[model samples]
Target: MGILVQEDKGLFHLQSAGMSYILQLVNDYPAHVYWGKKLRSGSNLEGLLNLGGNRGLDRLPQEYPQYGTGDFRTPAYQVRLEDGTRITELKYSGYRVVEGKPSLPGLPSVYVESAQEAQTLELTLKDDYAKLSVILRYTVFEHTNVITRSVEFTNAGETQLRLQRALSASVDFSSGDMDMIYLAGAWSREGNLTRRRLVQGGTTIGSRRGMSSHQLNPFAALVKPETDENHGEAYGFSLVYSGGFEAEAEVDSFGMTRFTMGLNSFDFAWLLEPGEQFQTPEVVMVYSSEGIGEMSRTYHRLYRTRLCRGLYRDKERPILVNNWEATYFNFDADKLESIAAEGAKLGIELFVLDDGWFGKRDADNSSLGDWVEDLRKLPGGLSDVAQRVNNLGLQFGLWFEPEMISPDSELYRKHPDWCLHVPGRRRSEARWQLVLDYTREDVRQYIYESLSRIFSTVPISYVKWDMNRCLTEIGSAELPSERQGETAHRYVLGLYELLERITSEFPHILFESCCSGGGRFDPGMLHYMPQTWTSDDTDAVERLKIQYGTSLVYPVSSIGAHVSAVPNHQVGRITPLSFRGDVAMSGNFGYELDLTKFTDEEKELVKEQVANYKQIRSLVQQGNLYRLQSPFEGNETAWMFVSDDQREALVYYFRVMAVPHPPRRSLKLNGLNPELDYILEASGEVYGGDRLMQAGLALPDIQQDFVSGCYKLKVQE
Candidate 1:
């Protein structure tokens, strides 16, 4: 069933894949009744409400929790009027069902390639008191257990409407027992999975750092108290936004749970003039009755195919070698060519030159805005180096922090007003660089053209778009004083516009977004760029947790994992070369090291890693992943990936720190056909799929810290 509307009972039931969501109108107000397994047709709605021995205001599920309904729970969506009023009420007005999904203007959203691929439900709720209207839009894909939700506000009344808090979607559950799972960390240690019980009262996670921040990601999962990778019910919400966002999970006094998500309310105020409308970003909702594993796979399939678009979306990315930790800012043409020559000999496909390419920029403190090449470093110019790398049989890639400007740069010297700064206040600087006020048309055009000029000079195949700092003096000269609150949101809009124009123009270029490495790794950025640098910490042991935590929601194809030199650049924890290579292979494999200095043995190992990865790139990038053992629970972590057709599988096992006479732990594999027989590539041993999954494969003995093993299993024909 797609979307069924019962006009007689004033109910809307949406069914997609194997799940169903039910919404009904009670006294003209929209209320959510059931959102779980597919229900039988003509099921009694009253029985699903679970009113707790009451049938009035206290028990009704408030779809848009309002102050006038005696629902003390936080209102789902909020706004204010120019007449100084925040007391608002919304009642269901009308709704319509459409064929295909509609794109959010100037925003990154999932698109339906065909009318038969998806169906949409647009429900209109009008606030008669403020003469404002709210459109609740939901799109259900025919073949995916995913329902995308967004809100649109239109000023239909006589006066201007100011929106202080307009959340995208909200759902209420009569049960209070659930566990909240989220990813939280800082800088190089991003995407650390954290789980806690959803107790009484409210728990909110968000980012006010302007660029989704490094502190918290814009996704959260609520599951049954006993939920795990293999069992129990789970509900996940991921906001399709790159900028600041807010997710609130609150439990009311009656032990009911409510989850709401949207743009962060802090420094966010939108003024909607009469006859104008504003659309909030989309929040993807997924339900899984089997467990969190099924929920994650649904997200992976939806985002990898629908959300991430471009030349690299379905194609396997070329193995790259980046010169960041290798030379930092102290590399010249000769030095870069030496590294590229070694990489080419080792089968690396791309070479990326990072930073210090232009304008007296030997360090991070200067030349951020100067896109021109420094003759002293390049001798002839960047074109010479690009051509040289091309002759070495490697595609050339370059890094640019185009959103920032140094105070001593030529561009900043000419246009001091271009940076974001409050009129009379001192501008705060991070990394000795100031953020550009992208809200200004002049600033956006200048930066866009500057980048275009660089791409025109060389046959660059990739660009690492990096933003090294956050917004400090968050003010824009283009916006008036009264509308300064709109700067943050408008800045995000400007960024999207710039990205859209550039990505569309240079469709051949492979763009990888890195905000201090994984800071801005959200769905919105993935919508423009296919992959993001997972993190800056290349330590093999640390990456075990980072990659595992990131894989909770994001697919392996969208993560940028690299093998860096040791003693590790970030943590000083040097491990075995093979261990590092194994961890990096879990994502878009690459190397971040000075290959020219590698020992003969290490060079051979690098070549072997590259060769091995190519043989199984598609299996790792486009396979069904199963998280076997959690690193959060023990010293050992294990994961496996089965090819889509179930003909092959790869299993990875890692031991962070070895213990004396440790207990043996068996990893039960998932996503395999029990009736098939499989052969071990390394051992020439054959076993039935059912035996491999039920009896399980025992881990090899762990002899040292930071050690790992990889197993390849093939179905016996």
Candidate 2:
């Protein structure tokens, strides 16, 4: 069993593939002891508990801290009674170890393939004073060193209770000098990996933008001072939520560090009536003693296999060409057909007609909620364009911004209360769009049914589900005054509901999530939609950093990387077409350029890029990834993909600048079978795996900026 209970020590030790999570009962409260490398003995806790006893309150690590506990640290969970009392002291009740994991209600969670592959521990604690019970769920996988945790709170008293704070998972460490690493960016640039020392007070990063905005992702990491990509200890935490969330790391006066992840505490309150319960979203935790690279690999493997679902989870994504950047709003049925024709000629498998095909929408300012086809753009409707593209030997895809409503549209005019707004308050708009109040059941049904109808009628093999704006007004007319604060969390729940319905109803449609671009890209969205448009910025130079940072926790298969025309649409920096292709090949390879406008030489280059991508698609999509060099640290970036069987590998290296005289850069490969002989496909050079990993391969010195190369290696039997 992966989960074992130490009766004598009163500890629940969860042993995953290469990690151990220890939870001990301190006096009565469940306390987290250690969560790093696997423990061979219980000697580590020799004096941890007694050390805190002299401080009056046992400062022993708490799984869920609360106020009035003598400890002044921030509580992991908070609740308020009917009389306005907001204190809770929960004691360990009992626990049950099960063979398999249980699915979280109305949320995206990792699944267990079989009972033999995983084990779950359901630990229950009771606050007898408040008549409340907290159930902490933990699941450990047998093959992957990942443990997922979530919380469920039940009100057993006769009075109605209000949950002021409910965090999914919390980890406490008695040590100091921890570094907190997170991702932060804006629309055109998402997932900029950042590292900072863990300071005192609260260090919080999250999104209150309804959708997990591009501002801050819900994933975080806490590492020791010596931690890096390939060394030391690091603990990674990612909330399996796509909506508003907060990841907080706080260092208390006692020099103890605690990390918590859950619903954003800002304006987030869930009302729980007696006999009712509230379940927080799940959080995936990975502990890597072998460094950040091991942490990334654990997350990559777990999410790729357990989190992301459907036909696209393990299959090669189609080499797609979206029409968003190519023609924008100027394209009509003829233009789309022409683009699809060119894409088919270039061996592209998917043709996505983005944005302008919808009702009265020539630009971004109108027709957002109107699902009907724009007769001006496509005389025969979206179905016609889909069929036209399908006839060109390409899978047809359509763009949809179903979450936004333009006030000037028919849906808004018919139901003025459909969009989120505050009574007598001015409604805020972004990109000239208002968010549909999905917290309303009617609104959710309308959007889901409308899109479902389109998917059923059109031959659409793919759907680019986009949300172009953040939430504002922050008020829901549907809820009462007291429940107004519940709007944000409720909105997220409604979104998950709508997504579940649509994806379940239209199982054949490949849904790719987009928020402007990459705004809502998180584990929660990946649960329903396997891939996300990495970013709206298609510049090769910019994407190198964006894709590299995103791949820290997200797998390459989940990132939507496309070769766009240069000067790129966002940054307007024109690089060589080959550079764009190489950058895009690192992810779900695709193109966003208008192929019809390409010159003869560019067209031939596009064809070659497409053909070459096919040769490495399987390896890139399913293989183990290794970050050889970081773009954030130097002028060059390098990464490699090794097959699961260690039989083949593909390495990508990019040089962003050219120096007058540069030093030689050697690339070292990882995760290869050391005893095997390997052959490089491009240069036909043969070397032993051990030699390649130890001595490293010398990369050719290209004297041009933005130049890249791909090296494919296969084991020589």
Report every candidate's CA lDDT.
0.89, 0.88
Q: What's each prediction's TM-score?
A: 0.98, 0.98
Worst lDDT 10-window in candidate 2: 45-54
Writing each residue's lDDT as its tens digit, candidate 2 over 551-647 gives 8899998999999887777877979999899999999999887889999999999999999999999899888899989988988899999998999
What would the TM-score be for candidate 2 when compared with the true structure?
A: 0.98
Instruction: Mark the regions of model 2 whose C-alpha exceeds 4 Å error after superposition.
Output: 41-54
lDDT (tens digit, per residue) of candidate 1 on 197-253: 988999899999998988999999999988889899999999989888999899877
- Model 1 clash pairs? none
Give me the displacement of residue 502 in model 2, in angstroms.
Answer: 0.9
Question: RMSD of model 1, in Å?
Answer: 1.3
